[model samples]
Target chain A: MSEAIAPALLAPGRTAGMNWRRLVPLLLVAPLVLFMLALYALPVLAMLSRSLLEPAPTLAHYAELAGDEVFHRIFTNTLWTTLVVTAGTLVLGYPVAMGLARARTLLPLLLIIVLLPFWTSVLVRSYAWMVLLGRHGLVNEALLAMGMLDRPLRILNTPLAVHIAMVHILLPYMILPIANALRQIDPSLARAAAGLGAGPWAVFRQVTLPLSMPGVMAGILLVFVLSLGFYITPALVGGPRDMTLSMLIAQRVEQLDWAYAATLSAVLLATALVIIAIFQRAFGVGTAFRMSAR
Target chain B: MTLAGRGASVALNSLEKRYEGFGAVRGVSIDIRSGEFLTLLGPSGSGKTTTLMMIAGFETPSAGDIAIDGRSVVALPAHRRNIGMVFQNYALFPHLTVAENIGFPLKQRGVAKAERARLVEEALELVRLPGYGTRQPRQLSGGQQQRVALARAIVFKPRLLLMDEPLGALDKQLRESLQLEMRRLHADLGITFIYVTHDQEEALTMSDRIAVMHEGRVAQIGPPEELYDRPENRFVAAFIGESNFLPATVRGREEGHVVAECAGSLVRATCTTNPAPGESVTLAARPERLRFVDGGWPAPPPANRLAVTVTEAVFVGERCRYVLRTGDGTSLVLKEPSSAATRRRVAGETAEVAWSVADTILV
Candidate 1:
């Protein structure tokens, strides 16, 4: 009896074979995971450790960050820039994302327009903005030709220029997630809302907006986190007084102040992680990433 | 319980819907009385759901006038029409709690907090889900989610309630139970219910009136028994239930019935249309109306008897279906109770199937 039961219970596909098949997926992923650990994880860990260990194993770097007025001002500037960029992208990208998701005939065209920026490198795009927004650039020329402006206007090398260029670079990131979220929502939900005596505005405010929260949260997180560590675009287009923390980190590294540079990088990384943790708690992590309302 | 005459009567006058010159619903004129349960029954793309959508103001009609309570509402949008609708997928808000979902309409109407809470609780209790208010819709089972959808649709007490295949997504057993519950609710509330379904049995069981649609037009509209027993055309006869059409030519007419020649025999059938002699006609009869008798072909064959060879006898639970073919190879089906008598005739045997002359329907 035991022999018969054991042979039947250990059916190949249900027992040993199934376990082996499961392990096959893990084995397939091993190479990529090991490569990431070696090249990415090691360097980030080393940089974070040097913030406490370079010259001495002390909390002095953090203490300096706590007290330094220049660091404080730069930190505030980084926060301000991230907030403005995130808000601007959300307000501008929302309608475009909605049109992309809902349009029947223009979807391919909208998609191409939204993704065209990604085909070009970010550095080239920043130079293109410089040429476009320059004192005598095409935008100014067009405006002057159309008699829409009195002068070419001081458009480049200002905080506004930095914001405009950053938003243009990050708008696609904001739009894609929101468009995906909106598309996942069943049109029947809106129809049901309308049938239940809700006006157009009410249906949008109550059904469409609430159902798209996951995408909005994702866009905010991606844009805000990306803005926090932005370096080159701001450095090229921003005024001197609009220096962010990433610029300070670069300046310190150029001066061979490794401890302060490592500290700044570590602080930025920690800030991003803290923000993610808070948002994950406020909006469940599943909802933050889930495409469907369910 | 407070709803009765408050329900609006809907009248569609020559309603027509055209899409790029193709008519989805063509010149459909129906007068739906207040507090009546009417079902639009048809196969998919037969324009039943399309008609319901037009009545709900989701699909604008190209040519028609729809009046609710004697006032034309074709120009009004869906929201202003004050209609409640339940979708096939039960579109409950996934993020909202059961109570919040039920309270959504009341909140939209600007009802106060205490009143909204009371109404939500009442609705939850009405749907037999009193303590499940705080649970999210995703946490509920499929049946519970459907109950919440029904509750949400009715919480505002709209003038008309439209359901588009609301139970089509449920399992058969659950669908039957919900059908009964829906009928009970319709009776208790006394509100007009315009339901759409492709299931014939569901329409027969719940509807006070059913409009059978075919090819964008209403083939027949009447009470369930009338549609089942006296279908207006061949499409209605075949669509409502299983039927066998026997072709014949009109021979003569009597006081209330017409005599037609079918397979070298005269078959007396009740015809809705007055057919002239020598005009072609088709006679239809349900399978259960036919019975098998001993003998292949008797001398002076009976008025409603046909010579058929039993090809297949399928025993299905309480009844057996016998597939038969005549000498000309025209197929006929006979359904009889699976008793000792019906078991005697096996396949590949000759049998005579008979029905009453009155049972033959001329289409």
Candidate 2:
């Protein structure tokens, strides 16, 4: 066993003979590797292969998708909604994350509150948004009773409703990473800034904000990539004019156009990966993380 | 040398800080001289750091006032006070390059960009970190980071500078080197530096005066030698250095010295804190002050003598420490420089220890 399993200590630059020690690591991960290859990668490859080889070995589906006016609108709509939802969650979550980092005694309860939304089903949460955003929903009815509204507001099935629901769903993803980052900051940095003649606002703008960039980048990456493929919230809450790439893919699949649906899915996956690459280029996570090292 | 500061004198009057019925500092007052380095030295929770924080305008005193150069700054916020402070953790901004971090204070004061750059370079050179301007703080070693923090604090040319155990995080060898650098920094800048540390040696080595704090109050404040040689109270005596305490009853006053009966011997010692006759007190004598009586001694064997048995003898490189037991079962230590001329005493040997009146303090 020792002769077969031992490293090539006696002979440098030589490969070891068949070793159970080396196989142990591979054996440990074999289940997960096999599961992903069979269930995930195989299906994804089969779907993508349909875009190129289904019914005929031709690129007609991709050529049509590029020139399709409706496809362009849906693609841009998806990009626009993803950007707004990311911005919305960021603007709202940064403060909550800062508060959560500072509220040490209340941290456990606050964390539970931040993570509570994940326990609810996405379909149920989308329905809850619908009930609250309908024509005679709680918001408009309250505004009308307060004498601030002259007529019923058209809020349901709008981009605003889609934005509200998406931001609510994706907020936890934004908050957790940012709070973890904020908690890692050496609090004395702010005090040091203040002592060095910086006012409160300058301290925040120069020290606190810059030091928390890694967390902010992580949050944006998570929320942006997640919202790019978001389907249920928008489908249940958005008007017909707010069709996204995922919605188009759903429509094509329902009409028995599997090749075009696969083409759209390929485009969505490639776009998401390209966007992530661009973000990485603009703000490398490694550099940001190293900058914050103690 | 050109960056020397016009040091501001700080006066903390009746400064008190209490949080939630717990008094962190109670009625502490100290008048700090300009260009003088004063150290607040004590154990943790002794209110040394609190006293420092109140001076830097970080903690609002529950009572009394703080004046910088005779101007009341009680209403002034920390940033408006123009006091530079170095925290215990260096506290360098992680995202900023060394130069940018140093230039931060100048930028905040609305200094022009060109001038700020020049001053940042000058400050870096002042801390011997020239050309490290573009390097981020994480790239520097712990000592280098602390020096950068020091440079940043002093670059703004604040009249006063405060430090809170800045060398506590470093190793002993690094701390010693930094201590020398700080003393030189103080001399070059000529700024009033208020430092807080629990290290007695650091306080004695660096400060023009040391304030020994205990339980929310300044137990004693004086020059290092004064605090070491003539401690006014038992706390100051015990806190500064090793002392052999002999419980005694005051016999009478003899020639401006307090005569006391201690450990089966009559002892004469200095007594600024006057003790009336028959009052119980403690006589504090440094170990080096006590000597072994031998034929080599002068005609009269000093003033006080005690019969003791050598309980233990420890050779600590330079000196031989003898732990002696008195007839009354009191243990006292006597340290003598190891010399080949004198015979060494072993445990269980009978010996007579002698010391002079001028060397002992009646506390």
For model 1, residues B1-363, the per-residue Cα lDDT tens digits are 467666779998898999998999988889999998999999998898999998888999999899998999889998788888888999998768999889888887899999999888887887788989999999988888999999998888876889999999999999999999999888767889999999999999999999998888889999999998887789999999899999888999887889888877677898778899999888998998887655233344346878788898788878888899876677888888777643557899887778777678987
lDDT by residue (B49-76, candidate 2, tens digit) is 9888888778889998999999999898
lDDT of 2 at B345: 90
What's the lDDT for all of these models?
A: 0.88, 0.89
Measured by DockQ, the strongest candidate is 2
Summarize candidate 2's per-residue lDDT along A34-53 as a digit string, tens digits: 99999999999999999999
Candidate 2 residues lying further than 4 Å off, grouped into runs, are A1-30, A287-294, B3-5, B295-300
Question: What is the TM-score (0 to 1) of chain A in model 1?
Answer: 0.91
For candidate 1, write residues A98-199 as lDDT tens digits. Answer: 998898898998899999997888899899999998899888999999999998888788899999999999999899999999998889888887887789
Best by TM-score: 2
Q: Is the docking of candidate 2 incorrect, acceptable, medium or high quality?
A: medium
Judge candidate 1 at residue A125 and give its lDDT. 88
Off by over 4 Å in 1: A1-22, A292-294, B294-303, B341-343
Question: Which candidate leads in lDDT?
Answer: 2
